[model samples]
Target: MVAWYDPGVLAKTGLKSLLSETIGRQADRRLLDAVARPQPLAFDYSEDGDGKAREELWLDYVSDLGDGWDSTYAVASAVMAPTLEVRDATGQVHHTEGGDVLVFGGDEVYPTASVEEYQARTVVPYEDALNDRRHRPHLFAVPGNHDWYDGLVSFTRLFCQGRRSRGWQTRQQRSYFALKLPHGWWLLGTDMQLESDLDASQVEFFRKVAAQMGSDDRVILCNAEPAWIKQQVKPHAGRGFLDNNIDFLEQRILGKRVSVFLAGDLHHYRRHENTEGRQKIVAGGGGAFLHPTHLPRVDTRPDGFVLKECFPSQKTSRELTWRNLLFPAINPWFAAFMGFVYALLGWGVAANLNEGAVSAPPLREVLSAALQSTGSLLVAAGTLLGAIAFADDRRGKAWQKVSGGVHGAAHLVVALLLTWGVSSVAAPLASELQWSLRRDFLSGLLLFGGGALVGPLVVGVYLLLSLNVFSCHPNEAFSSLAIPDWKNFLRLHFDKDGELTVYPVGLRRVPRRWQHGHSPEEPVWVPDPRDHRATPPALIEPPVVIGRSKAPPLTLGTGQLAPALVTQDEQPPAGPV
Candidate 1:
């Protein structure tokens, strides 16, 4: 599980941001750009071994990958398998092979980006899946926010070296590149870094790529973030801001030739399509912790693209949001930290405990004592402010401020009430015992236990209500759960006649049990066959076809129409060929 809410991870993320900002100030990294490497005019894979224009091409788009071993490896295993036969809703099986070109959309590693992290979380899993394949896929990637964490030094070194992993070849010189595919199609991947804006050098690089594109040529623009959906979430940020880099590239550089906009920062599958059949898709569910799909309620984009489909439908997402009620169980370390805080707050109150009357202290006296202690006051103030800052602004900025105030107030009120109640009860007993060591120990035990047990529950319930009732904290609520299911990726096929079809592949559950393979021919690790969670891949939706006047019959790499689409009158094939 990638504990996004974990304090250590959060601290590291903040530190990364600080360091990146410092680097940005000292030297404009993007301008210096892939520094010594010679920029390629364009990587043209439009031809076959005979130097003739190829009739077909297959590509894979995956992003937001590289989290835990179980989740990451599960997705990698499914993707790297020689072929997949996924059954759709209507029992139509969609059979497809690993892409000739595997493009990582963005955020290849999570929490933080580094050589070790990528090697362990990403490279190792992918390499282990298919070690000795004859025809290896070419891999290209654009840097996401996570990839930008180390100032992109690690990303540039690992990916831009033009080296090869066990089962894939790295082909891009810079963090971004353009691939000229067959049948008048082009794939352009951009590195947005953390700013979500392209540098002058990047803009010029794309302009050169655009210069090579014919007017009728269609393009698949890959970005690190989905600006269309993001406009709805943070209306004033990124591409939503008038004439941002994305708007410029779409409007000026690529123009109407950009038939498809693909991105994957949000860890889910969503497709927004215009009436003209242009598609904006987000398929970020490679291996990271699942993000809630029932958020921002973006039924439409400003560009007139209507939301067509979302994997783990909004209803399922809302249902999954309810799991935050188990936050204490999911994040026991955080819960224990909260317990320590409560213990400190309680100790502050108990330290004021003197030889008072044998009876319980009055409520006013308890409150007064707590208010006088600087430590208690600071803790209460910090809790109130931190809760306020933690609130998500999905509804609006004003609503966020109001909801946050109430949330923080609830915590402070609970603390005050608990302090009063505990002090009132314990004062009588401490006075009777008249032993400082025993009294101190009892107070410490009580406060720590109470905080540990009660504090996390309060937080969990607050998260549950905020998300279910108010549509807030979608990221926070779900990240705390660190769900490893609902992983997905896109496999696209461009057939002989130039028609393109996208098969959205998904897995309902990731296998938890694994064993090392004994032979060189076998994968490094295989899922335990007895694991109940081992399920076949399924089509997230019917194959989405593009650029054809009418829907064409789907075909496989063997150049035959797919055998998986059986009619009611005919029995399906025994298995995928």
Candidate 2:
């Protein structure tokens, strides 16, 4: 039901994106930090006496949510569920209760942020999931690009104030915040805004938190975007890498104390570990469309980070990319729009020919007329420019633009050919049948039908080819599929012996069918058991352990571990585990 290819959806988001890049960027909302009253808890975290008082803590991390009901709600219900019992691929079972702290990594709402969208797509389902519970988890979030579309107004209103988001207690006073976890571990979230540029206030806030951290105290850094992966996929044209802000904070402010770097903008589960056992994870599959895990086509990063685990698998992601070939079937509304455009192109061509002439127009004239007409030229130019703009310009503007131009030309040629075929067929039929009155009308009708059938197919094939062959349009490629599976989030636990464990939780397929619950305590919408795709959550890989081991992790062969383990998100102590 959530079609990214829909023309209306495209136009609306496109306009908002334009506004965000131009007007929203000019007048940065984060500059209004003076408005927050500046809560003490926002910075200070020295009360715990260096992890001696507390024994353990749990926390949950999810990001890039708020799309359709089924997928988003499925994840929301799972995260808010009192307990989640998941198993690894080898059938090792693990169980975890809900966290005392819930961290939204970024992109809490999709398709342009608004209060209405946040309520409908994010709040309603989350509230319905756990509203009846007496104890509530504290919520913290960093803003992603989608959240920045409206200058973070909606995000600030909903999250910055210490209000309740129905079931969860909102605790952050600014867009970014730091929390002190048990056992000398800390969580720090950064708001890199639109340009990946941090404000002075944000830097000062983290610097204060860093000063309190002892030499052995570990930190978990949560960012909206996964700069490690983006550095390879879409690096800045001038700069070789894209993580300057993170590098500065990690080295200069945090003093390289960050043991884990977590993010969710990539929309899939991927974990990379360096030689020191430090983890970099991208677990963004929190309800929006799934992104490919097979991207960047590399097993390791230049910084010595090796790709250790990924959900949906790289092979599965490659196979999924092929689904875009059925574009018209996948997104019929977009196909209809393409059909309308072809019909208009046909009309423009016919208008150039003499209305009274009975003879069929030559194919050459049909093609020439398509080239000469002003409306037709506009259509051609629009297709080329739109495709070029959609291209991932970070891949080098000149080559990306040329590839996009070729993609647009494919669509243009197909439209022109379809127009000629319709005219050739319709003209002969009209002359033979002596149906003089409806000749032009019949041609117009044929053009619409043919274009509807073929236009979308062209675009789909273009996306498929561009992605798999050239490594382009990674966002556009998978978003067209709107895959509901491969949903994932992180559950982190800090244990008594000053060790941190990360569990990557994933769902193979979200339930499509739902039923309304009659009970007051239950979620309003529950996953219907009758749905074939309904299945239990599973662990994407072995639980990653940090702080105890400086060497690279050992491969834990598939086996049943006695103690069932999972992850959580929280700050300080809300309740005993």
Candidate 3:
């Protein structure tokens, strides 16, 4: 059961609360203190350093994970909008509520991360949750691709600066610092250093950090991208600051000291135990649109991952699973059904074009005329149905409503006119050009065009008729009847209120009613009302009541009926007996 709320509102409120509590109070004190002491100048480090130096430094920082966590310490990472929360082995809440460190994953803003993007994406609901937490955890972040879309200068300047001053340590804000936790837990911050390259010095720094770790302790590496996994699949891709340093650490310095690799970029949660026997967790579903999932194939191993649990926060946890959810490409059943229909229509057209065919001009003309008339009716009905379905009731957004109506009407007119024109003109042209092209080509083209145009109308009419039939006499038995040939026969139907109704094929006569409240054990016979060729009854009787005498039988019909069931207006209702 996921908790739902307006994410924008939630984020705004949260950020306001956090600013008021943490930075706001600090700023107030600084302002008062400023009267007595002068404020320091803020520095912009962008121009002072060369690109290569900066890149090397970034790599060095990521490769090294200092000695494992101290017995009393836990390293907290704040991942941006991680839809899923982290739980310890004992099921203790480690994220969402509060954590030791905050890791800001990339895409802080969806689609693209810009200044406005931050206001729209990151600042809202996340800020609210951050403010509500009792613990004020230290924050560190790696730049996600979206964060870097505009470059890392903005992100670094905002988080690294302290007291609005510049310098490596002083200029950097307190919000983006590495902390040595109580139990020897060392947390490092890398602010979207994906583009930079790592140097030998940085690799040495990582080695020093790894050397300090013990068997009982573990080092946790954090980043926006899963470089290790990406490298495994695509080694040719260049290593960034973090990747270069990680390569050095994995090959030279750290043998097995590093245990956990945490990342959030793919937009889907995944946990893979790499060949090195380390847990790689990707917690990306942080209120962002879901990513396609990858299904397990013969070439892919199960890899020991399975969905373990889902939390009320819409957070799902899996046991070492590597899954990718893929979006549906095409529905094969729909294609196959349409193909069969076209084949049948093509055969009919081919037979009609036979040179030795019997002379039956009257029958041919009548059939063509009937088809044209039927096509017109279908187009008109479809357009009206589409218009009704597309109508919106929510008021006040006048432009949206008007545009929607215009779109619906346009589609309706196009469908109707197209159908009528095509049916009327198609046969005559085919007859005239019968000698110009091969019989198969002309027949195939006509069938394909007609099927494409009529598919929706057929589906719509079938659905409407089916609903009318079903509503006429509702019963449990009717519910059990499987809609026959629904794929082939039924047309999609839309009601005035934009509700969809589907009528399956071969769903004609109602089956015998079973015992009261008891469903039939076997399948029942029902015709699909979508088969346009079939005719249904003009009028149907309304539903009837059938209940035990002791329970009090009730009758159902139009308007008011069964006065006993209705609440009395003149007198207060009696207390329950």
Candidate 4:
């Protein structure tokens, strides 16, 4: 359904992105703060007088969502945590359950991350789902890139304001917050940056959070995206932004370790146990296009971390192919016709095999064909590249323009040569086609249109990847695609004994249409007895190995945020963790 060259999904709403950049963000933040009046909560895990307030700690997490489509409905249903009867291998019937805390990892919507978009896309659907529920859990969230596109101003009003939108409310004073779970456990989430680090204020906030923890405290850390999976897939792992942050938090801030890591950027479910004995999981399938879980790896590239488990496993054979173009609403901002355009353009890039000796059109026709094929993709990639170069230009001198020009020329030359070489190699075969095939206009189109993807797909895909190495975001090397598969999430429970049991629920079936609102399909209890990634045995589990996070008890002051947190139009502030 998704290919590097088939149909390019262009990111739109450039005007909104521009407005947010120039003036809209400040105005939005000011308006939201004045009208909504958010007061973020700051709670400490160690401060829980007694851990027995609740028998079990229940929480449901979903991330990278907010597209209003069938898939979105499916995800909303998945969040409902409906009762499902599944027969175990031994033929015993069992039902999986849900949690008391419902959290969203981020990316609540797409295309123009403004306030108007969230009320309908981010808040309404979930509100409907929650209202539809018999039991509703308290909701909390961390900001993802799409959410931050408007500088998190609207997200603040929509979710962070003291008042609740629907039933969802954010109590955290800042974008990042900490939740004290049962059994000396903590859940920490951050408002993250791309290719950047936490600002000094955020670091100080978390440091105070760290000061409150006893040395033996356990933490379940959450971030905006499931970056670890791409650690090996991309040339750089989250541009080392997340890893540095995590290291700083554990080593510098807390002087301790994290028990688990959860994130949702890639839109699928996977569980990996890192060499450090921590369970890193990706559960972004909260109502968005499903990204393929597996990717091709060059033989020479040594494998990165091995995934302990994944829903839609290797047996499922999920792939990124052109057939996905048929799915409507996959690209909400771009028209489906654009896919055909990308496809035709790819074919055009290779169509020139008949430009000379064969009965092909003139130079004008070839140029026309090539231009049509690459027009949109080139503009998109060029716009992104131009922004980056301009950023560089601002930091230095006019020389950045010269450097950019030389780089462009070199890349253009290489791209043209590769295209020509591939075309030349295939031209010999093109010359021998049957006259019936050659003369039939419809037949010729049917035969050659597919290759049009190679035009922009080739030059643009490679360029997008090459350019990504220099920074992050808008890199094809880091893009994902959709698939028709089960969406999933993680539900964690902490019992009286302080042992944790993680139930990874997979919604195997997505109904095509439903009259009554969709509910969660049957959930599977991922079986892993000895693995720390899953639930350990209740009675036989090893004792919690954490050290006291802090001294006997520290009399912490008020919340770290002064008047408020995140007031400025955000800049990419760099700090470790």
Best by lDDT: 1
Residues 1-577, model 2: lDDT tens digits: 3689899999998888888889766776776763544745343332344634667777899999998787888888888877888887798888777887899999998888999999999888789877564357788988999998887889988998888867788877788888887666788998986577566556666767777766677788998988767667776532213324455566545644778999988889998888877888999988999998777644688878899988889899989999988888989888888888888766778755636656767879888887789888887888789778766675687977898788788878888888777766676677787875766877777778788879888888888887788887778889999998889998887777878878888888989999987776677788887897687678889778786533222222121211112114312133221
> Backbone collision count in every prediction?
0, 9, 52, 31
Best by TM-score: 1
Query: Residue pairs in steric clash, candidate 2?
Result: 59-568, 59-569, 59-570, 60-568, 60-569, 491-567, 491-568, 492-567, 492-568
What TM-score does model 1 achieve against the real structure?
Answer: 0.90
TM-score of 4: 0.62
Query: Model 4 — which ten-residue stretch has the worst lDDT?
Result: 535-544
Measured by TM-score, how close is model 2 to the native structure? 0.89
Which parts of model 2 have CA positions greater than 4 angstroms off? 41-52, 238-243, 351-362, 428-437, 518-521, 548-577
Give me the runs in candidate 3 sitting further than 4 Å from their true place: 1-97, 131-135, 162-177, 189-217, 232-243, 274-277, 295-577
State model 3's lDDT. 0.33
State the lDDT of candidate 4 residue by residue for 252-280, as single tens digits. Answer: 45443466778887767776664545567
lDDT of 1 by residue, 1-577 (tens): 7777677888899899889877865775667765667779778889987899999988888899999888888888877777878999899877898788999999989888899999989999999987664357899998898888898888888888888889689988888899999888889999876467676667778878988877678889999988777767766443333225555566656767778899999888999999879899999999998888877557777668998899889899989987877877888778778888787776777657634535556777877888898998888878877887888875677877788888777766666666666665676676578867655566676777777767777888888888778767777788889989889999999989888899999888888899987765667898888897677679999999997443222222211112222236644355422
Q: Put the candidates in lDDT order, highest first.
A: 1, 2, 4, 3
In angstroms, the error of model 1 at 70 is 1.3
Better candidate number, 1 or 2, judged by lDDT: 1
* Tens-digit lDDT string for candidate 3 (282-391): 54444433322232121122444233211111211111111111000122233234333433433343434333433333435434543555443454455455544443
User: Against the unseen true structure, what C-alpha lDDT does each candidate score?
Assistant: 0.79, 0.78, 0.33, 0.51
Q: Judged by TM-score relative to the true structure, which candidate is superior, 2 or 3? A: 2
